[model samples]
Target: MSETSPAQRRPSGELEASVLAALWAADGPLSPAEVQSALGGRLARTTVTTILTRLHDKGAASRSRAGRGFAYSPIQDSAGLTARRMRSELDKQDDRNTALARFVSQLTSEDEQLLRTLLDAADDTPQRPGTGPQAAP
Candidate 1:
């Protein structure tokens, strides 16, 4: 049996990112077919649909019934997506404080200073309505 070449396959995360980018570029929500076309038709419609479905399950995207199929829209920008991933990873740890301390230790001096400033600002700011965690739908 012949093995599939890496070039012939996309990393799942990369495909998700591409789909998210297409959604972000679109002025309105896009169907899987539209997403596939926006991605230069490199991916199959089913593949695009599956990626969009996964993103929706992860709360990274939202979908609503449009005609016969669904139209998907990204709930978060790229930076928000990255932050979600980071938070997810941190949540997996039994010792979140230790994990965060290690992560902070790995950051550059500038990043550390920025983190300090952000933390200070966060301490002063009041939690705005609908800005923190929301109840699951």
Candidate 2:
């Protein structure tokens, strides 16, 4: 059998990221065929469908029935996606304190300051609706 060309081979992680990017770029939910088209038609409809399904399972995307197929949309913006990725990685560590300490040690001074300010602001924020005690009807 002939070997796959470099252009024909992409890491599964990269393909998943590309699929998510396509969904995020769309103004509304897109069927797998639309997602394939958005990615320049390089991927098959089945592949796009599988990727979208996996993303939906991972909470990165949501899907709703459309015609005989399903339309997919990103559940979060890019920043939210990045945060989810970071949290997922952090969750994998058995030594979370050590991991966090090492991560903090690598931060740039500016980033360190920004993180401190953000944490401070978060501490001052009121509990969001439905999270705190609810008023009696």
The number of clashing residue pairs in each candidate reads 0, 0
- Local distance difference test, each candidate: 0.91, 0.90
**For residues 1-137, could you state the per-residue lDDT of candidate 1 as single tens digits?**
32347777656588898999999999999999999999999877888999999999999999999999999999989999899999999999999999999999999999999999999898778777766444234
The positional error of residue 63 in candidate 1, measured at the CA in angstroms, is 0.2
* Minimal lDDT window, size 10, model 1: 128-137
Highest TM-score: which candidate? Answer: 1
The superposed Cα distance between candidate 1 and the true structure at residue 135, in angstroms, equals: 18
For model 1 the local lDDT of residue 125 reads 85
Q: Candidate 2 overall Cα lDDT vs. reference?
A: 0.90
Per lDDT, the best of the predicted structures is 1
lDDT of 2 by residue, 5-124 (tens): 878876769989899889889899999999999999988788888999999999999899999989999999999999999999999999999999999999999999999999889777
Residue 111 deviation, candidate 1, in Å? 0.9
lDDT of 1 at 14: 89
